[model samples]
Target: MILYIKYMVSLRCKILVKDELIKLGLHYVIVDLGTVEILENITQQQHDELKKSLLKSGLELLDDKKSILIEKIKAVIIEMVHYAEELPVTNYSNYISDKLGYDYTYLSNTFSEVKGVNIQQFIILHKIEKVKELLLYDDLNLTEIAYKLHYSSVSHLSNQFKKITGLSPSYFKKIKMKRSGNLENT
Candidate 1:
């Protein structure tokens, strides 16, 4: 039995789903983001119980094909941005199409219709979020972070970061430091 789950975006979400399956005494074959495969077929009652359990943990089982595809797209993008060591050499549209085995036009249209943003914008948003995460770590310099995120240059990274965050990277880092210091004092 295969289950398509919504909002299963992080490692913690995967762990929670795995724990739930174990609690239900269900053996799973795979538990990737947004999808799970069980070793045995489950009864309707078990499915219902599993659904209820997932819901309690803030996850949802997707039944519709379109919704499932959308979740899959999100899962792939999240994995690429947050987990992958290197970005694809090709353009994201080509990469996404090849990865999903769907035409770029169809994927773009579907994602835009469902997400209210174009796929490129979605990728940029995720990239920016990743940049923020790297900034927070403070392990890399801006130039290094820009290269790590595949930005053309530090200026380009700073420009986009400022456009999205309303503050330069340095300023953002300073603000975060201030907050941490204040928290320590409190």
Candidate 2:
């Protein structure tokens, strides 16, 4: 049986879920982001126990088809933005469509309806967060960040950063550095 889970976006979450499954004596064939495939069908009692255990860790077992699809969409996007070694050369829509085996229009409409934002907007938000993380690391220049994140140009990245953060990238970095310095002194 394939189980869809919400908030299973990180490696830590996978470990937690795997541990819980082991404790419950459930044999899982695979545990990937937002999904778990079991070797055998679980009884309702086992399912309820697992659900309760997972709830304590802030993960949710999705029962509805729509919710499962939505979580799958989110998992794919999260993986692409945060964990992918390199961005795909094709358009993101095509990549997502091929990955999920759903029509792009259908996926976009479903995502917008469930999330109150388009998939493109979600990608941009994740990209901005990634940019902020990279800046905090102080490891790369704006041009490098833009190229790594697949932004067209540094100016494009700067404009979007300013629009979303209400601060220029340099100002944001300075603020973060000041905060870090304060923490070190105290």
Candidate 3:
């Protein structure tokens, strides 16, 4: 049985889901960013109990097809932004459409209708958060960060970063404040 979980974003979230499955005596084959594959099908009682437990921790087991699709979109975007070492030179719309096997326009429209933000805006938000992470690590220069995140140039990266964050990348790094992504989505 496969279960889609909404709001499971981090490695810690994966751990929490795994622990919950174990506590419920459910054997899971795999637990990825936003979904879990169980070795055996679950009973209604077990499913209800799991749902309640997950809700307490701010996670919800997605049952609707549309919600599941939205979660898949979120998972792919999150993975690309946070975990991938590099992004393609092509535009993100083409990349995402090819990856998800759907028309870019359809996906973007659905995402915006469901999430109240355009896909590009979401990508920018995630990319900005990635920039914040790299800056905090102090292992890469602005140029390198721009390249890794697929920005055209350091200036472009800085421009977008400032537009989104209201602070230049250098200024942000100097301030050393704990920066983060969109809380509702991330």
Candidate 4:
């Protein structure tokens, strides 16, 4: 059985889900991002138990198709922005559309409807979060960060970062204070 889960966006989340499955004596073939493939069919009892366990850890199993699709879209975006070592050469819309096998308009509309924000808004939000992470690390300059995040130019990145975060990239890096919406919230 394949189970789609919400808020399973990080390596630590994957590990936690794997541990929970093992503790429940369930065998899973794979656990990735938002979905898990299990070796054995699950019983209602196991499902309920797993749900309760996952809930305690702030994760939920998705039963509805629409909700699952939304999570899949979010997962794909999150993976591309955060986990991938480098950005793709193609435009994000094309890359995401090809990856998810859905039209860009449909995916964007669905994502916006479910997430209460447009896809571009979500991408900007996430990119800003990435900039915060990079800035805090103090390992990259504005230009490098801009290039790493695939911004057209440092000025463009700074403008967007300031618009979303209310602080310029340079000021943000210098302050090193807690900005809202980091990895924990996202």
Candidate 5:
């Protein structure tokens, strides 16, 4: 049996889902972001209990097909942007469509209607957020970060980063350092 979970985005969320499943005495084959596969079919009592338990922790057991797809889209994007070792070599549309096994136009239309932003904009937003994280880490130069996230060039990355954050990457990193310095003195 496969179950979809809403708001299950992080590693911590995965752990919590696993813990809940164990407590319910349910055996699961997989507990990934936004989805789980179980060996045994869940009884209504067990399902209700699991749903209530997850809700207490700010998660939800989802049943709506469209909502499930939307959450799947979010999970894929989060995994790609934050957890994956490298971004996809292909374009975002193809990557997403291939991952979900759906037509890109349908997925794009649904996402735009529900999220009020086009898929490309959504990808750019996530990419910019990743750039901010890399900048804060100080492990990679701007050029390296650009390449890692598959940006055309450092200039393109900088422009998008500035447009989203209203600050240059250097200025953002400087702010973090300045804040850390002030905290150390206090």
Candidate 6:
């Protein structure tokens, strides 16, 4: 049985889910982002227990088909943006369609309806967040960050960064440095 989880986007969330499954004595075959496959049929008691336990941690057990599908899309996007070592060379639409085995139009429409943002916009937002994280690390230059995230060029990254954050990358970096007491870096 495949169980879908809402907000299972991070390593910590995955660990929390595994711990919950273990506590429930539920044998799980696989636990990936937003999903868990179990080896046995779940009784209502077990399901409710798991659901209640997960809820205590701010996670949710998804039930309806649309919610599951939407969570799946979110999981894929989160993995792609925040976790993947390299972004796919293919366009976002095709990458998402192939990942979810649904037509891009359906996925796009569903995501827009549920999230109030198109998938591409969602990707941009996530990418910008990742950019901010990388900047905080002070490990990579803007060019390298742009290349790692597969931006067409530094200008493209800067444009999207400004659009999403209302601050240019350099200005954002300066703010972070000043806040961290590294004014010399700024």
Q: Give each model's whole-structure lDDT.
A: 0.89, 0.92, 0.88, 0.87, 0.90, 0.91
Quote the positional error of residue 64 for candidate 2 in Å: 1.0
Q: Tell me which of candidates 3 and 4 scores higher on lDDT.
A: 3
User: Which TM-score value belongs to model 6?
Assistant: 0.92
List, residue by residue over 1-186, the lDDT tens digit for candidate 5. Answer: 999999747779999999999999999999888899999999999999999999999999998888888888888898889889989888888999999999999999998888899888988898888888888875999999999998889999999989999998899999988998999999
* Candidate 6 Cα outliers beyond 4 Å, as residue runs: 182-186
Which should have the higher lDDT, number 2 or number 3? 2
Residue-pair clashes per candidate:
0, 0, 0, 0, 0, 0
Better of 2 and 6 by TM-score: 2
lDDT-best of 1 and 6: 6
Instruction: List candidate 5 stretches off by more than 4 Å.
Output: none
Which residues of candidate 4, in runs, are more than 4 Å off?
177-186
Tens-digit lDDT track of model 3 for 164-186: 99999999987774343344346
CA RMSD per model (angstroms): 1.7, 1.2, 5.6, 4.9, 1.3, 2.4
Ten-residue region with minimum lDDT total, candidate 2: 2-11
lDDT-superior candidate, 1 or 2: 2
* lDDT of model 4 at position 65: 85
Tens digits of per-residue lDDT, candidate 2, 19-98, equal 99999999999999889999989999999999999999999988989899988888888899888978787989999999
Q: Indicate whether candidate 5 or candidate 6 has the larger lDDT.
A: 6
List the candidates' TM-scores in order.
0.91, 0.95, 0.87, 0.88, 0.95, 0.92
Residue pairs in collision within model 3: none
Q: Which of candidates 1 and 4 is the stronger one according to lDDT?
A: 1
